[model samples]
Target: MLHLLPLRTPLAGLGLCVLAGAVHAQDTLTVYGIADMYSEGIWGGGGRVSRLQSGGLSGSRLGFRGRENLGGGLNADFVLETGLNMDEGTYGQNALFGRQSYVGFGYEPAGRILLGRQYSSLYNLSSDFSIFSNLSNGPSSAVVGGFGGYEPVRGSADSSTGNGGPARINNAVKYESPVWGGFRFGVLGGFGEVTNDAGGNRVVDAYARYAQGPVDIAAGYVDDRGGSVTPLAHRRSWIVGAAYSFGSLRLRGAYLAVDDRSVANQDGSGWWLGADYRLGVSLVKIQYVVNRPRYIDNARTEGLGIGYEYSLSKRTTLYTGVSYFRNQDGAGLGRASFSIPSGITSGTDNDLTQWVGGMRFSF
Candidate 1:
């Protein structure tokens, strides 16, 4: 069950309580969702697979959010988002609200504190500098492994029980600062939910960024304790990224590193570069990503992806893409993110190639 904090004593005694009540009565709530599907084909070291599935272009999802102006530059806000699979007719992320769920109050020029399951600060900042917007392309791909979301053991993940690791943490408390002169930051921590562990069992993340004119710079770090309640068993990652825009053309670059003290042979680092050109409502995007796992020879992986997207309206878009991956000696792990997760598995095909076509609609 989700817990809510009690109002401060002073605020409760003063007229603030009444004002909050009045504002709460005028709050607004809205329902929203996105649907994306794709046809995908892949040839990997594992095998050749072709299938239709939900793509990660925007990660099909449904959400409900609301806000209430509480006066004095303060406001109450909450979000509940769930991942959905249009093809399987099932909830994608395993939890009732897997994508995001948080409630908090915000101050106009200060910041806000939220409580519940939420996205890592690193992921949020990283997306700002990604041409692919943290999709299954470019340097964002390496982020999966860096954040300890990599499935080195395969088969199943802690988040899904049979898929992969967690993207959002539970029992989390987060703080996000308001932008000041194009500068902002966010921090987060997820308790282990165990009594005896104390501060050792927690997931912590932080990020900061500055954007002005045509240039943007961002940096982030995350220390994940994984599923263990032990302090030393931690997986950590840090990244620095930048993006620049000129007219209709934009360029993005990033360097990411991971310290996998919790897993053997999983420690590694990599980088990515991306570019895109916008022509009215249409865009062409391409990215190159490389991953190097520590202590493993010929066990490196790299990929190149090219994609095109056309917006049909404010809430609809059409997209298609192709990806090619090369896995050195022992590096051909499992699958590459072809947007279509299932169809892109690298089944023993050292050279993994994939094709995808999809459309997304939001309402």
Candidate 2:
């Protein structure tokens, strides 16, 4: 359920009463969430599995947000959001408020400043410009971002290593600029907070985006310094993406590259192209992605995905999708944003496939 609450305060003193009246008129709070679940059959790693899962099209989440207008075109706002696993009735991201927790202030013409855990700039770019919007299932750019676990840049609670890049940074400070001529940019820095080590597990990310009319373009970069007790490797990644819309059809594409400084020949790159078409209340999407690893000999993976969505209402949707991945030379890539089961390995020249049907409700 979603709720909006208006706050009011009555003060004892007449002067205080006047102050409360001014503030009460500008404060608002809201609670909202999405519930998503899917049934799927996945075939890969020499086995087939059928089950129900959460987050097929989008991750389920609950969140609270509030904003206070401080007058003079300035405002303060905060958000607390948590991911949910609808299937198992569990927390999705391991930590409470793992999806996002931040407080910030914004000026109408200047921009905003925020502090706390938040999404990385690279993730924002990829999600915005991709047809799937980096959903948890089907053919998503997440697979390319985390290919072979060499560059899992998605934010996580773990700050000790950069094995998977932080999708959301912890203990972070961020700044976002106001849009100018359809251009805007943001920067974020995450503090590792390791004792006696200022730079341990640190993260720095930045992104710039421009959108006008039917064209949108964006680029982002992230550098994660991995290490808790001892210094490990540093993971650096960059991405560029673009999207164009014409009538009922939208086309998008993105390219991403990753470099791990700890190991030689561990760099990799990936890219995807996708399109979406809308017909009345129904939508169709198709995407193709490729991943190439520099460390593996002739190791590569390609994925194709097709999806359909029907809108029953503004708040309800029915969706189905299928994805197929072809892996060569021991490349062990699985479905987008999903992990291969433990003890099951995709051997050389193996292939993987997934079929999913689901419903989503938002409030």
Off by over 4 Å in 1: 1-26, 137-166, 229-232, 263-265, 331-335, 338-349
The residue-by-residue lDDT of candidate 2 on 1-363, one tens digit each, is 543445443432334434233334547666788999999887876777888888877789998787888999999988889999888898866678978899999998999999987888777777877777776567777767553354444554253353224677778899999999999999988887777878777888899999999999999998888565336657788999999999999999999888878645378888899999999999999999887776777777788989999999999999998998777765454334466554344554367788899999998
How do the residues 149-206 of candidate 1 rate in per-residue lDDT, one tens digit apiece? 4532111234532111234667788898989999989888788764675555577888
Measured against the true structure, the TM-scores of the candidates, in listed sequence, are 0.83, 0.90
C-alpha lDDT of all candidate models, in order: 0.68, 0.77
lDDT of candidate model 1 versus the reference: 0.68
- Best model number under TM-score: 2
- Deviation of model 2 at 160, angstroms: 4.8
Scored against the true structure, residue 261 in model 1 reaches a CA lDDT of: 78
